[model samples]
Target chain A: MDLTVTGLSVRLGKRAVLHDISATLRPGRVTAILGANGSGKTTLVRALAGLAPGEVRLGSARVDTLDPRERARTIGYLPQDGAVHWDVTVESLVELGRMPHRAPFAGLSAEDHIAISHALAATDTEELAGRLVAELSGGERARVLLARVLAGRPAWLLADEPLASLDPAHQLGLLDRLRALAGEGMGVVIVLHDLIQAARAADDVLLLREGRVVAFAPVAEALSPDNLRAAFGVEVMQVRDEAGRILPVPIGTNR
Target chain B: MKRSTLILGLTALVALLFLGSLMAGKAWVPPSAWFTADPRWWIVAELRLPRAILGLGVGAALGLTGAVLQGFLRNPLADPSVVGVSSCAALGAVGAIVLLSASTPLIIFGSAMLAAAGGMALLAGLAWRSRSAVAFILAGTVLASLAGALTAFVISIAPNPYATAEIIDWIMGSLTDRSFSEVQFAMPFIAMGCVALLFTGRALDALTLGEDAARSLGIRLRRTQMLIVVGAGLAVGASVAVTGVVGFVGLIVPHLLRPLTGARPSALLLPSALGGAALVLAADSLVRLGPGATEIRLGVAMALIGTPFFFALLLRMRRSAWI
Candidate 1:
């Protein structure tokens, strides 16, 4: 199904974080929101999943018109900081992702159990199932949470800086995983601080500055030196001359 | 171990301890009496047996509800005492003791339930309407102190000979003279509360990542939290209504169960229930045998026991980099 956004606006604390932002994403594609810190990247993705206050009008029909309960079943979001305090087992933590699918009083059904197992396998956490979350490292926790998101089998996966805490290997590994999910016909939208990584992984990129889209197009035009300098006010160089320009680093700090 | 094995072990421990509580009271009875009726065994059964069982039920309810509240609020310090549900419950029991201490058993139990529920309603409003955990604790503290003062006011006006004495016991918390009927009355509310909390386990797990994160995942945050508050009130408030104010069972039991369940809120719920019941029952037995002819307030005993236990836990946690 086509996921379209039209005339979407959001306000946080009476300040308009995004004003009239609109875009469309296909089912089998990776879309990226590239921005510096505090540039409203987190808020935009959150608004799409109904985490932030915003109007999500899909064409003429309002996304807000859908029952929030119904809306939650179709979308899965992994936040910037995966806050955790309890020391629950990895299996239990992942199974919680199945909440929207169950009735209030009944415990996990057979279908729920299969989803939990599949999630553990997908995130490579089957061996860590019995271990307490407290005993695991940050990377392990992130993987478990990703497995949690995947358990829901939602149409769209929205993640905020899924690569931030991960090391380079895991970062690249996670990007490949997201790309694979998109190939499986799931819409994957990620808010990324790493422009080079975003360029490599995404089909379309939206560069945001001051809570508005500075550029929205195929990754090629969006990652050009002019766009990067305008959005971040930093000079950078690129390498790959493909559909997307890679910006791991620019030529020099000196203009 | 698997979830099934841990749950089984916890259940077995509760059963063995449940038996220990029955046999360990004053005026020890023959071991054979436990299996069948003896005329002499009737006295023990008639008096102390019900009190200890009631303690188990109340303790279990306290622990389970505590686990639920702490999970939902993401605060380890939450318990009925911290939230004023216990104090309000005490006030309810005190109202009966003050006006008609010798009233029919039914009236005393009924009044206790009503008072505790009233107190719970106030605390629930504070926690539900307000978003902050610190604010919830503050509101509970204020309500508890107000109830405490009101209880004192009622006592000051009383003309009975024991009013002054009973006031102290009521404020502190106790398990003395608890009858089978008290247990029977509280069992349903506590059971229902336990069911309510367990059912919300998935929602609680979603919450661990953050409220916003949970909401985006399609969990109805307000609805889930409201269920938790109501469940906490019934389970905790009814528990205190029966046994006065048994503290720490709630705070400590979850901590103990978390390791086995691996710290997920959903997995910890069942273990907390069983573990809490066993702990309170064991502590109740210990205090009964400890250096006291008069009954020990179970609440007082738990605090005395909980400190060293908690200290050990903290030390282990610190070493493990739990902060």
Candidate 2:
């Protein structure tokens, strides 16, 4: 599935947060949205996920026009923090992902169980299934929440700053899992602050300045120094590693 | 405890307490009297039965509403009484008693309902303005205090001494001498409220992930809020209309049941309802057993029993950040 956004705008009270943002997010790829603070990256993702009032298109369907259940069926969204309030078991928390699919009064079906197990296995959280979510480390809890969204088996996953709090190793692991999801033809869109990680992991990149899209292209083409400097008001330079691959580095912002 | 065991145990406890409540009074009525055409049986059938049934309904309503409010507001301390709905309803009832000479039950019921709805509307408005749980708790405390003061003010300026005495008893919360008419009036609203609340179980569970995630998962925040607020208002309003301001049952029941139900807000509802019923029945029985000419108020008994538990829960929440 391909997720598309056109003329998406958001206003919180009187202040405009996101304006006329448009992009194409293809399946079987990881797209990272890079922006500075208050750059409306979160707003754009929220609008795409149908959480905010905005016009978004997913394939031929209008995202905002779809019912909430249909929207949930098509897209799984992970907000930042992803706090689980209760001490529920990991399996039970994951089972909640099937809510959009199941009837309100019905018990979980065989298909639901299969999806739950696949989600657990996919996120490598099966070992922690019986344990309380509150007992897990921060990275582990993030993975469990990832499993929860995965259990819904949506065509696209939209995550806001999902990698913000993770250490380097855990970030790499989660990025790998996300990459695996993309390899399975699920579209993954992530909001990120780290330019290095974006250069490393993103197949495509969308750079935002203020509320508008500045660059939307393949990672290699879009992460140019000029685009980086414009989007973040920072001096970015490209350096070659021992592997002879170019990497983008942010040294400092001109005050 | 396992979910099934917890549920079953609560149900059994409610039943046992209910029977004990029917048998308990100023004087012991034998079980044999229940089978025969004795005056004691008349007392059981007419007096104790209605009061016991009211106790069950009132308790269930308060407990279920408490659980729903806690989830809706995302605050563990949220309850009908604490949030001012019960006291608002009490103010409505007392106001009616003071203003009207020989007010009918229907008028009192309507007044209470309106007051409950108004209180909920205010809470909803405050919640809309500020989504912070602490803000909501503070707002609720303010509203509760205001309603309590209004109730007292109305009582002091009551038109007659009889009206003042009636207001005092009602404010303290009592199921004494309540008839089947009160039960019939309250049951439908209570049942509707329970059904509405239980239907939001999945939505509330989704909310444990917070509002944005819940909305992304297709849970409509406005719809869920409407269900919770309206359902709780109806249940709590009708309950207070019959038995005034039954404090602490709502607060205590859900807290006690949370750990047993694995802290899942949805799973805590039924057990909390049953536990609330049992708690009220037990407390009412204690009121009857208290050695006094004038029966100790059921609400007073619940406060006496529940205040320590509330303190313990607050300490535990402080230790664990469970709130």
Candidate 3:
């Protein structure tokens, strides 16, 4: 099912962060919301995930109107900070994703176990399952946090800046994982600051400027020099890599 | 250790300590006296049995609330006593004793519970705007000090010296000479509070990922907050009304058991409850066997034990730079 947002506006303490935003996010595709700071990328994604107040629909049903558990079952969201208060083990942390599916007082079922194993395997975190999250490195923690979201098996996964603080290799690995998830018929939406990474990994790009959409199109068209300049006020030099993929590298401010 | 083994061990420990509490008073009641009609049986049936039962219920209530509050607030220092709920309940109990001349247990129990609920309400209201841990702790400290001052004021203006003495002794907290009536009065509230707290384990588990992610996982924040407030209020209120303020069981038990439970807030709940029961029973029994001319009050004994542990915890936290 496609996730749709229409006429969505969000105000955080009298300051409007997302204004009249509308987009249709499809299943089995990765949509990267790209913008500079304060462009409302997080707010837009939060609204789509039903964490913020807005009109969002999954297929035809209003997402905000759906039961919280049902909404949770369909949409998995990861915040930017990804705060873990307790020093629980990685396996236990991943098991938390199964909360929306399990009945109260019921132990993990066969389905939950399978999902957890799949998430661990997909994220290459099977060996780290027994280790405490507090002891994990930044890159490992990012993967484990993503695995937690994946364990829920939600149709749509919304992650805000999941690549922040990750090394280059880990960033590429995460993008590959997200692409693989999309290939397996899961809708993946992520907020990204790296234009090259977004262009390489995302099927489509939604560029925003000052809480308004500058362009929502396929990566090639959406990340054009004009759009990049308009959205981020940056002059980007598009360079083709060995795989013949266009990579936009920001050169300087668009003077 | 395995979760099952830990739970079983804690349960066994609680059972052993419970039996020990009944047997190891100032006058020892041998196991043979339990079956045969020995005059010492009265000590077991009438006096020690009720004390032991109250110890179990009150201990479990405090421990479970401590774990729940710690999880809910995402603060390790959070407990009924630390967050001023116990002090507010104590204030209410003191008011009832002063105003009603300690006429009825029901009046005192109800007043304490109501005051605890009010304290929780005020705490929530004060800290609602800020999600920061410091704000929550500051609000709790202010409420606790306010309640403490009111309680002292109530004591100062007591109608007579006898009432003042009784108030002071009760405030020291003891399980001595308690009968089945006190158990009947407090047990139901404790049980209800425990049941409510147990239901929050899954939510607390979800909350380990923080508020936004927990909400995305379908944990109802408001409902969980309500359960914590009501649960702590009733549990701590009834405990104070019956045995006065039994300090530190809530704070100490959870911290001691967290390592064994792998620091998962949800996993720590039951073990903390059992550990709390064992700790209180052991402490109460130790006081009974003390060399003092009179038995040390349970609250005073717990403070004596807990203060050093708390200091060590703070020092460790400081060394680790957690603060």
Candidate 4:
């Protein structure tokens, strides 16, 4: 089912963080929310995931109306920080993703094990299965954490700043995986800072500027030079190949 | 080793320490005496048996509380004693001893448990108000010191020197001269608290991903937090009411057993509880076997044992990204 956010506004201690943001994230499509720092990207994602109080609808059902467990099963959320406090193993950490699907007191079932293994293999974290999370590098940790969220197999996945800690190669690899996940009928919504990465991976785009959505459209339309300048205060020069596809890049900030 | 194997090993150790504690006192009771009309049988049944059982129960309680508190607060350094919950309970017990000496043990137990619940409520509130880990721990330290001062004030104002001494001895934490009544008083509360905490294993594991993720995982934040606070308060309060403020078993046992339990808070709970029971029993035995005619207090012995371990953990944690 497609995830939709409508008339969503969130106030953090009297200061508005997200203001009347609305977007329809289509299934089998990767949507990237692009915004300047403090422009409510994280708040918007949270509101969509029902982590923040707001109006979110999963197809026909209002998200907030659903019970938390039901909401959890529908939407897999990965927070900005991928830090796990304990020195837990990668396999154990990934297994926690099955929490919403399994009974609280019941042991993991055969299906749970299958999902966990699939997540491990999908994220290419099988080699790090027995290794402690504390011992892994930043990029490795991110993949393992993503695997943790993936093991739930939610219809919609919301990730906030997932690409922040990853290196260039890992970043491309994870983006490819997210795109592949979207192709498999899961709606993937990610908050990204890199315009180039977002332009390359996202099929749809939602641009926010100071808690307001400037545009929510196809990547080609939403990332127009005028919209980019308005949303990010930058004159971005787009480079296209002979086939007229945009090679996403920002030449400079307009100050 | 597998968590099951570790739990089994710890259980065996607890049994051994329980038996050893029964044998370690100023006088030893023979196995034959257990079934005979020997006066030593009374010692075995009445005195030594109660002490050993209380130590095991109280230790298990503290250890479980420590593990839960660490997970709930997301701070590895959190302990009932260090975070001031134990002192708050002690304050309640001390108040009862000073003013309500004529009152029943049940009333005192109630007061201690209530005060502990209040303290935990306040600490959890402080933690909620501020998301900073440093603020949470500092608030706990302040609360603990405040409770400590209040307990001292109550002791100072006792009606007689003997009463003051009695209060001091209790605060020092001894399994000495305890009867079956004290064990009877604490066991139910501890068990109730433990049952509450035991069910929280999955919630705690979900929490390792942090509050937002845990909430997104359908772990009820309010319910989980309530269970942890009330459960830890009940368990630690009951234990403190009987044994005074035994420090660090909660901190030490969980830290020691976390590796064996895969460092998963859920997996750590049972082993930590078993390890805690063993640690308490062994420490109680050491108190009995020590050189001094006046036995070393259980709380003091634990502090001495646990402080070094705490430093070692701190140093090791320092080398990594624990903070």
- Encode model 4's per-residue lDDT on A1-255: one tens digit a residue: 878888888999989998888878899999999999999999888888887778888988887668889888889999997768888889889999999999877989999999999999988899999998888998899999999999999999999989988889889899999999999999999999988888888999999999999999999899999999999998888988565668568888887
Of candidate 3 chain A, the 10-residue stretch with the lowest lDDT total is A45-54
- Return the TM-score for chain B, candidate 1: 0.89
lDDT of 2 at B280: 89
Q: What's the CA error at residue B308 for candidate 1, in Å?
A: 1.7
Q: Backbone collision count in every prediction? A: 9, 0, 0, 0
Runs off by more than 4 Å, candidate 3 = B121-142, B321-323
Q: Among all windows of ten consecutive residues in candidate 1 chain B, which has the lowest summed lDDT?
A: B100-109
Instruction: Name model 2 segments beyond 4 Å from true.
Output: A240-245, B118-146
Question: How well is each residue in A119-168 modelled by candidate 2, as lDDT tens digits?
Answer: 99877789999998878887788888988999999999998887866778
Worst 10 residues of 3 chain B by lDDT: B128-137
Candidate 2 similarity to native, TM-score: 0.94
Model 2, residue pairs in steric clash: none
Candidate 1 clashes between residue pairs 3 or more apart in a chain or in different chains: A87-B262, A87-B263, A87-B264, A88-B262, A88-B263, A88-B264, A89-B262, A236-A250, A237-A250
Report the Cα lDDT for residue B264, model 3. 78
- Lowest lDDT 10-residue stretch of candidate 2 chain B: B127-136
RMSD of 4: 2.2
Of candidates 4 and 1, the better by TM-score: 4
Clashing pairs in 3: none
DockQ of each: 0.55, 0.72, 0.67, 0.82
Measured with C-alpha atoms, the lDDT of residue B207 in candidate 2 is 85
Highest lDDT model number: 3
